[model samples]
Target: MLDGILAARPRGFSLAARYVAFALLASTLNLLVQMAVMGLYHGPWALLLAMAAGTAAGLAPKFLLDKYWIFYDRAPGRLRGLRQFILYGLLSVVTTLLFWAFEITFHWLGDGGPLRYVGAALGLGLGYWAKYHLDRHMVFGRA
Candidate 1:
């Protein structure tokens, strides 16, 4: 039964599965970075700083994994990779804003602590999901 289920997986399921796996890794890294920063600092700016730090920390690894693994975008040149990275950054700006809004709103609502981390996780999850489609269609393009 399990083998039948695995065999019946859709054409792009493997790619999506890999993407989700890598995204989870990146998201976890992002949350850890945010939590670490929050632990050391407390203030309005600290929240912003932590968000930015977490985002930056997760960006490069996510980009590499998406480019080389998920999208299979090996175009054989630095320029292509750079252009893709720029597009990724641009798309990420939109998702980052979405993440920040949710995170900030939840943080204020929860009054900080575990709830704040919960907010961050929720925000990051939503952002990464949206980003996968955007990255697939816009940044990396279909394989």
Candidate 2:
């Protein structure tokens, strides 16, 4: 039954699977870093600072993996790579807004407990999935 399910995946499923796997790993790291920052800091802006740090920490590896492994984009020029990174950063702003909305909403609803993390997880998952499509067509223009 497991073999049958595995065999029935459509084309590009493996690529998508790998992308999601890497995203999960990166997100986990991001969340850990964010939580650690939050723990050490004590101020009104702590969450914002932590979020920024977490996002920055995870972005580099995610970009590299998405560029080389998922999109297979090899343009062979630092200028082109910089252009791609700029585009990715633009898209990231949109996704980060989505993530922040959910996270802040949850925090407002609940007093910064597990619900906030739940919101962050949901937001990041949705953001990354949307980001994959955007990156595929807009940034990489592969598929």
Candidate 3:
């Protein structure tokens, strides 16, 4: 579905635009998953569980979209693709820390309420921005 949309983009539609669109979609999915998880589980582990579920929900789609759309790179084989995914995960560590910092801070300050999502959104935005450059230069060899 999104692949078709990306494929049918106008000639003037820039790569940045597509990337942003994909990011927004992935972020939305992440947030939605977080909301659902938090809604379902209000136990002591609500924040932890929600964040884990949200990140898991968002990751695979983002990777596939980035691999096929943003960088337009194909994995040569199974092992190489796994290696690429692993490298991508490693590069994400720093950004993930940034996100966790914001999220945990807000969660603490706001008593684990809506403000946490605000922090998460901000963190994810910044993280995605940095992640793009990292993935471009390091993972995709497009520097």
Best by TM-score: 2
Q: Candidate 1, residues 11-78: lDDT per residue as tens digits?
A: 65687687778888998999899889988999779988988999999998888877777776657788
Ranking by TM-score: 2, 3, 1
Better of 2 and 3 by lDDT: 2
Give the residue spans of candidate 3 off by over 4 A.
1-11
The superposed Cα distance between candidate 3 and the true structure at residue 126, in angstroms, equals 0.5
lDDT per residue, candidate 2, 1-143, as tens digits? 64353334346568868888989998999899999999899798998998898888988888877887788776789999899999998998899889888888887778977788888888999999889989998899995
Which runs of model 2 end up more than 4 angstroms from their true locations? Answer: 1-13
Give the clash count for each candidate.
0, 0, 0
Assess candidate 3 and give its TM-score to the true structure.
0.87
Model 1 lDDT vs. the true structure? 0.83
On the 0 to 100 scale, the lDDT of residue 44 in model 1 is 76
Q: Where is the poorest 10-residue window by lDDT in model 2?
A: 2-11
